[model samples]
Target: MKKHIILSAILLLAAALLYCSGDRQQVGQVTLEWWQFWTDPAIKPTIEKIAADYEAANPNVKINLTDLTWADGHEKIVIAFSSGTAPDIIELGSDWVAEFSSAGQLADITEDVIKDTANFLGWSAGIWKDRIYARPWILGTRILFINRDLLRKAGLGENYVPINWDQLKEVCYKIDSLGKDIYGFGSNAAEKHRLYKKFLPFFWAADGRIVSLDGKYSVFASDKAYRALKFYKELSDSCSMVDTQRRLEDAFLEGKIGVIISGDWLLKRIKNENIQLDFVTTLIPGPKYPGKSFAGGEYLAVSAGSANKTEAARFMEFITNKDNQLLFCKANYSTNPSSKAATTDTFFTSDVNLQTFVKQMNMSEMVPATPQWVYVEDIIERMLEDVLFNDAPVAESLYEANHKIKELIFKE
Candidate 1:
């Protein structure tokens, strides 16, 4: 009887100790919900590996990732915020940060991020009301992709590349004259959110401003904007086939299109598919010189409603560090790391084609940072469609767009 009691007591003590150990282990463990937009099969693994590595380093932290698509991600995020079920961290397009930050949906992270502005580019995309709400991650820019064979067949040497507005127009016309069902330019059609990006570069290259620096009014009705629109219409009507960006890229790949302005995603597709085509990328030709291209990027932001703000911020800082960002950028071939040090890696410095992108990115400009930009983008797209497709007068279209934008910005 004494032995039985002693054995039972020992087993009870052991069970109690194990239960306490398990309880203690759960005390400091954290699970974070992370929503991101990189859904490519080739790139998703790298993203998972990044999160896994972060978890391995910080054993008490866990990340649960949810993949989002560009098509529906914005709508889903808005719904999540409204339902009070937002994630701990979100990977937002650079254009979206301002909208969320200004609406109080994003956590203000100015003090949590690095103070060195030179270390990362595109900081303005993440700032709203002078407060930083996101960290720039992957940066990319659009450049002109030329079909070398088309240029040569058009009686221009392979070495011939457009350097200015007149040269570009002349080259495009020459290519169009080939008359074998080939197009000189791949112009974007009425893509609601996209046509504005294609059009704004021309506007900016012609020295157009959409709004004043104070964000108080629209300056989009200037002669520069009208001139830009007139030129765009001429180019589109003369030698271009208008289509969605995807169809345009497919046409470019099929050798039916001569020149197209596209970002690194196209580059990645070409390299990945091992397509055999002679082509080169160049900066967008300007009215007088090489013009500024549109700069776009991915950014990381903590959700204002996250329960684990500190842990979320730490994870963001970790993943955006030089080494991790370089890894991510390497896996995503056409993208540059936001980290300045990562760009110094031989991977970027050694490639001549990538150097073209680097040069263009240096001269690129982002759209204005404003919560009203979504409405403004829609208005501009409508204005372009009016002139480019509906035959609306360019000057009148600009006046209407400028008026609508002014109402959106200055309205009470």
Candidate 2:
């Protein structure tokens, strides 16, 4: 009751604030508080420049920007929304749209804006049950990074990359010169949420998805689920790779591993470290299916308690527009959700390697898009890791997971 009261007070306060802004045309003044996730230094200036441009066009409106980490942003937004002190605009993840929208803490953007304002991978990323709540920022799919230098010494070709599990296994088998100081693969498979992020593709490419479209159940206990876990085990055993996510990144960064699965974020580090590695990024592999991957991107939404909801949406629409998306992504070193931008831009289109990621995004599957997903995916990941590393029987582990998922869907 106290929480609801607080949220209500906030709503009233914001109503009054927006009311005040309405009369500001007399003085020609409006100011919006905006929040964004942390950016690469190169990208930060570009974003700030976007704000400057907007300010120039609308001299009466001022945007006050705040930077946040993903983890930090959640706590901050929750408190702000509860107290009616939330900013006018904020950045969010795709998975978060439903959670925030249902809380009555996000603006219902359906009638006011044309969602096609920006070209993105899939409009569905920010739309839930036919209502759009957020705008996408950056998008890119995961890929395999190989150290071509390591392959040659293992009697593999000077330039080699794996397209499937069998090929990856062959490379790992030949390249696991443990005593001679080499490992085949590595990943931060131990980071709880991240482990799932890294592994979702394996589950997806084998013709599996995390949740039913109705958002009611998990398929982790299904046969396809069994195959997904089984393949991870096989891949881990044969590749001589460690199960931890950072360990895998560290191994690849050190140039000790022949292959590692990573995203575009690693590009700068690979180039700067002078690792003598000719790495290529490609879709992850599968046996029963061609290797598909997961698509991850960020989105922006306005707080329901925000006083500047209308003005905030204007900024969201403007920033995500095709031309701005190009400027933002090119500076950010990541992909944007803008599908048209992605299809036509010389940056991604001209490069086969970069295009591979966009292709994988099309074939990708999303994680369960529920607040319960955090808990559900956590429970599912640990069970799969236990089976993969300890050789736990696939059927029993999957059974336990599927039953729990159903229980959770109701529980949530």
Candidate 2 residue lDDT tens string, 114-163: 64644355556666666777776666678777777778878888667677
Candidate 2 similarity to native, TM-score: 0.86
Output the worst ten-in-a-row residue range by lDDT, candidate 1.
18-27
- Total clashes, candidate 1? 0
> Predicted candidate 1: what Cα RMSD to the true structure?
5.7
TM of each candidate vs. truth = 0.91, 0.86
lDDT of 2: 0.73
What lDDT score goes with residue 152 in model 1?
A: 95
C-alpha lDDT of residue 358 in model 1: 81
What lDDT score goes with residue 66 in model 1? 99
